[model samples]
Target: MIEIKNLSKIYKDEFLYRNFNCAFEENKVNVILGSSGSGKTTLFRMMLGLEKYEAGQILGFNHKKIAVVFQEDRLVEWMNVYDNVAFVLKSSVEKQEMDKLINKALELVELIDYVNYSVKDLSGGMQRRVVLARAIVCRDSILFMDEPFKGLDDELRLRIITRLKVHWRENRTTVFLITHSQQEGMLLGDIIYKLAEKPVKFYKI
Candidate 1:
């Protein structure tokens, strides 16, 4: 479990979260919800140690393996589909096994046909899927995803979300997904956290 108490991050005139507090259960899907600039992603950054909070307590599985998909695809344009996934996998993967998982991940994201294709050649949605598949295939215990489905169509979103839910369930991995939509947040969240500027509130949605 991860516990955060009285956490705060401030820069100049901006305050990400003041006296923020929460606990994240292990092996569960936790959704962080808010409109733009509501400090949801800011809080995520704090949790990931990307930004330092002024004052608070944050405790979780220390040195736990983490994987992320930022709002941007973050894919290497020059790399082929398989190589991107292979990058994070080297820590615990053999060449042949990595190849197998890359294929499995691409297929899961409906991009198996593009396995040999360069990321530069893929469309936005297709690249998003590849990014997602890369993160998911990391087989990490904790995942942080920021707006991974932003530009996806309804059909693609549902399909990818369904596959993600299934994969997470099978592995019992802990997940933190940040999104602006209530619908998207509620779809796969076991717990929902809402962020606001003045007073942050969290509840089961």
Candidate 2:
């Protein structure tokens, strides 16, 4: 389990979090639901150790491999779909194993047909799937996603959500996703946390 105790952060003159406390259960899809500028991204960054908190303790975060899907695609525009996913594993796996994993991830995202296409050439939704494939290929113990389904239409979003559910069922990785969509929470979250007005109240759904 991941625990946050007395978490606090300040942005400019505003208090984002003040003595906030929450816990994320292991091996489940945990959703953080909040509006823009409510500090949902900040909380995710703090948990991932990508940002610092003024005063807080984040337990169960050390020595664990973490994979993240940021709001932006963040793909290498020069690289093709296959190479983009392969890039993350190049340092850790042999060429044969890397190809196998890349193939499997692409298949999972239904992007196998476009394997050789450059990331810059794909549509927004396709690029989003490539990002998902990249994160899934990592097979890390923890996954963090921020508005992962941002630009997709409803049908595509639902399809991707179904695929993600299957992936979670198979891998049982601890997932922490933040989004403002209640429908997404209903579809993907095993445990949902709603971040209300500041001093930041967290309520379970």
Candidate 3:
């Protein structure tokens, strides 16, 4: 379980949050819903320790082996799909297990055929899937995704959502999905958190 207590961030004149509290369980997806500039992305960055907050406590998590899909597709331009998935991993997984994991992850995103293709050659949605593959294959208990399906069409979005739902259900991985779409959040999240101008406001669905 992940516990966030009194997590607050202040930048310049803006207060991202203050006395915020939330709990992410071990085997479910939780989403933070807010409009752009609502500091939703910053919250995730702070949780991942990518950015620091003014005051807060994050417990039961380590910096190592935590997989994330940042707001951008931080894929290496030159690396192919398979290698990119392997890139996030620190330890050298055995060949057989690594192969199986990679294959399953790629299959989840429907990118198995493009495993060897350079990420730059793939479309934005496809590249996003590669990043998804990397996060899913990390085998982490916690997965953080920021606006992961922003650009895809409905059909593509539905397909990826379907695939992700299965893996997330089976793995029982703790997931944090940040997005503007309440519909998207409703599809996979067991609970949804809505953020207002600063701290958390309310959540339903």
Candidate 4:
């Protein structure tokens, strides 16, 4: 589990969180729902140790590998689907092992057929799937997704959601997802947190 105790953050004299406390359960899909600029992303960054807080303690995250899919695809335009996923692991794993991991991830996302296709040529939905594949292939202890389903239509979003549910069931990795959609929260979250101005509220689904 991850715990946030007495958390406080400020930016340009605007307070994001103050004395906020929350806990994300282990091996579950935890969703944080908030509007844009409501400090959902900031909280995620704090938990990932990418941002510093004024005063707080985030426990159970140190030394744990993390996988992330930001709002942007962040894929290398020149790289094909397979290479983009492989790029994340190429520096650490051998060729054969890298190939296996990449293949497995693509297969899980149902994009194995497009493994050689350039990301620039793929549709928006396909690119999103590639991004998800890359994150899942890392095999990290925790996964973070920031508005991952943005820009896609409802049909595609639902398809990707189905894939994610299966992936979580198989891997059982701790997941933290930030989004603004209530439908998405109901679909993907095991525990849903609603963030507002100062205090944050949450409920189990």
Candidate 5:
């Protein structure tokens, strides 16, 4: 389990979190539902060490590898889908093994056909899938997803979510997903928490 204890964050003289506490179950899909301006993304950034808090301790991730799929599709526009996904992998990984991993991840996102296509030429939704594939191939200890399904249509989103569920089940990767959609929270979350208002706190559902 991962615990956030006595977390406090103040941004521009306003408090985002004050003594906020929460625990996330290991190998589970931990969903955080929060509306705009509720600081959910900030919380993720803090936990990922991209943002700093005034005081707190995030336990159980000391030496673990982490992967993130931000709201933006942060892909290399000049690179093809396969190369973009391969960028995060270590050089020591065998070429055949790396190719296998990339292919499986692309298949999960239903982007196997676009392997050689440049991300700059793909649609927004397709690019997002490329980003997802990159994260999936990492096989990281923890995965942070902040509205990862933004560009995809409802049907595609649902399909990818189902595939992701199977992937997570097989990999046993701890996941923290931040979204405001109730349907998304219900469908994907193994442990759900509602978060809103100032001085952040989470209410488990």
Candidate 6:
């Protein structure tokens, strides 16, 4: 389990989170649902150690491998789809193993045919798939995603989500996803956490 105990964060003298606490189940999809400015991104940033909080203890992540799909695609525009995913893997991984892993991820995201295409040439939705493929290729790492399907059409989005559910079940990678859509929360989350108001409160559904 991952625990956030007595967390406190103040931004510009405004309490974004105050004495907040929550725990996420391991090897499960923990989807966070919140409106804009409800501290969803802030919580993710703090958990990823990209942001600092005034006081808190985010436990159970020590030395664990972590992978993220940020609000932005954050891909290397010049790199091809396969290379982009491969880029995140350790150099110790053999070429054969790397090829197997990258191909599997691309297949899961329905981007296998675009493997050699540069990210800049792909559509926004496709780029997002590349980002997801990258994260999932890190088989043992926890996955954190923020609006991962923002640009995809509904049909493709649902297809990918189904594939991801299967992938997650097989890999047992703990997932933390933040989305505003109730459909997305219901579809992807094993446990849904709703965040609201100042000093955000969690309503587990």
Looking at model 3, residue 104 earns an lDDT score of: 90
**lDDT (10s digit) by residue, model 3, range 27-57:** 7888888898888887888888889888879
In the predicted model 6, the residue pairs found to clash are none
Q: What is the model-wide C-alpha lDDT for candidate 2?
A: 0.90
List ranges where model 1 is wrong by over 4 Å.
Answer: 11-14
Candidate 3: which stretches are off by over 4 Å?
Answer: 62-64, 199-204
Tens-place lDDT per residue, model 5, 1-205, is 7999999999879888999888889999999998988898998898888988899898988989888999988787889999999998966478999999999999999999999999999998899899889989987889999998888899989999998888888889899999989888998899999996787778999
Across 25-98, the per-residue lDDT of candidate 1 in tens digits comes to 88988999989877778778888889877898889859898988898888889999888878899889888888
TM-scores for all candidates? 0.94, 0.95, 0.90, 0.89, 0.96, 0.96
The ten-residue window of minimal lDDT in model 1 covers 196-205
What is the alpha-carbon lDDT of model 3 when measured against the actual structure? 0.83
- Counting clashing residue pairs in each candidate, in order, gives 0, 0, 0, 0, 0, 0
As for candidate 4, its clashing pairs are none
Q: Tell me how many residue pairs clash in candidate 2.
A: 0
Worst lDDT run of 10 residues, candidate 3, spans 196-205
List per-prediction Cα lDDT, in the order shown: 0.84, 0.90, 0.83, 0.85, 0.90, 0.90
In model 2, how large is the Cα lDDT of residue 3?
95
Query: Once all C-alphas are superposed, what RMSD does model 1 give against the true structure?
Result: 1.5
What stretches of model 5 exceed 4 Å from their correct place?
none
Q: Higher lDDT: candidate 4 or 5?
A: 5
Better of 2 and 4 by TM-score: 2
